[model samples]
Target: MGYSKDAEHVGALGAGQIAKACNNYLHWVHSASNVEALALAKRYGVDAEKMREVLLKSPGDNGTPRNFDRYRFTWHENDIDLVLDLAQDGDLILPMAALTDQLVKPITQGEVVRLLGEESCVYLGQTVAAREAGLDD
Candidate 1:
């Protein structure tokens, strides 16, 4: 259960921060994609729980889906911003990171909890679709 073997010194200075930013960027992107997949399932009446179970056993599995309920939304925005800032400093173009930043900016802690909660099958996309369809909550 330990990842100590994965730890190593990459470079002289500031490399750790860059590595951390890259890790956070992947984490945020994966988390967002997990939610989107769940939302897609709900939309298609595919049984969210079953979809999640299958996803856990499939190649699509990641830490996000396995630990969905335990995820915290506090630092996602800041983390993505750090990534974008790093990309800007390097004069690199990262459209996906920019899109991820925008998509994650509007999410609230309560929304994530409610959407991904153990006893709940409702997702943000489901709610949005309902609203657009003129249905009542």
Candidate 2:
């Protein structure tokens, strides 16, 4: 942990906060990736729960990477805002993160399941309807 005033660690006051923001940003990326993948799976008739199980045992982080158990250590409500604030201050543009942020907003706001949203369901249904209507080959 970087402290404000100390000879031990050479850093300023916002150092710890910056570290936290970066970590949270990475968490957001991973969480959004998992949610998007699951949503796509459900769209194609694969059982969501079964796919979650498969992801958990895939590899890395002892299954934490694919953990669907919500509200434990997932992104809090203000986390993304904080990260975006930091990015703005640093003049950084995170386009992918920004895009994923919109994709997972409903889940974070508790409008749907923690990692799955009704929006995905609606989108998937629309795709199916279009296909049935011979919109695509």
Candidate 3:
């Protein structure tokens, strides 16, 4: 009844915290990407829920799309901050982590549900229009 098979020592002390931060970073990235993909599908006149169902069966499947509704969306900022800080300390550049940090704020603010809802196509359309207009710059 233990984690004998699932556990492995990664490194010396403090490594576990780093590993946890890395895992959290990926979780945030994946969850954001899942919402964005579904929103894209909804924009293209595809049923996002149906697309999600298909994606759940595909090689791109991750538990995010399935468990998205139940996600707490809390503490992500702190976790990503830790990851970014660690990267900075190591003199590394992680653009995806930076982007995830930005995306997580809106997701935590309940934007994910809005982005996946029925009216999301309009929102996505406007977003695309804005980007094309160079408003995103």
Candidate 4:
């Protein structure tokens, strides 16, 4: 716990939590971005799978190549909720997290794969419902 360590020496408590929440927010946003791109590819009759494979190879932060496996749904929904709640309690406004929290509310384990697409590490129920409804592909 970076925050815990910081608190011990620097009196930092919320900083680490805020940083973590923001990072989680990015993950949700990227997950949605990937899923939406796949859905659009499917609509255009493009090879969605191939596109995902290529995109994952594309550069990310610091020009590092994206790894598809990193996006796979693996986190339990409860974990996401816990972070969102923490962010809220700390007066942090993680819009993406708030939105993602709502999105994951009804998702089930079985639907995580299809909704997140390739290499989804964390399952978000909202992604599942959106995919199942033919809205997210």
The lDDT leader among the candidates is 3
> How well is each residue in 53-96 modelled by candidate 4, as lDDT tens digits?
66766662321114433433556365577777887777977776
Off by over 4 Å in 3: 1-6, 114-117, 121-137
Higher-scoring candidate on TM-score, 2 or 3: 3
Give the Cα lDDT of each candidate: 0.71, 0.55, 0.73, 0.51
- Give the alpha carbon lDDT tens digit for every residue of 62-87 in model 3: 77788676687888889899989999
Query: Which 10 consecutive residues of model 2 have the lowest summed lDDT?
Result: 124-133
Greater lDDT among 1 and 2 belongs to 1
Question: Candidate 1: how many backbone clashes?
Answer: 0
Q: Per-residue lDDT of 33-94 in model 2, one digit per residue for the tens?
A: 66566656665655555667777767523343444445453454477777777778889997
How do all the candidates rank in terms of TM-score, highest first?
Answer: 1, 3, 2, 4
* Model 1 Cα shift for residue 4 (angstroms): 7.4
Candidate 4: what lDDT? 0.51
- Would you list the rank order by lDDT, best first? 3, 1, 2, 4
Tell me the tens digit of each residue's lDDT in model 1 across 26-105.
Answer: 88888778777876665555555577789999999876677665766779978998998889989999999998887766
Q: What are the candidates' C-alpha RMSDs?
A: 5.0, 7.0, 5.9, 7.4
Candidate 2: segments with Cα more than 4 A from true spot: 1-13, 59-67, 72-77, 108-137
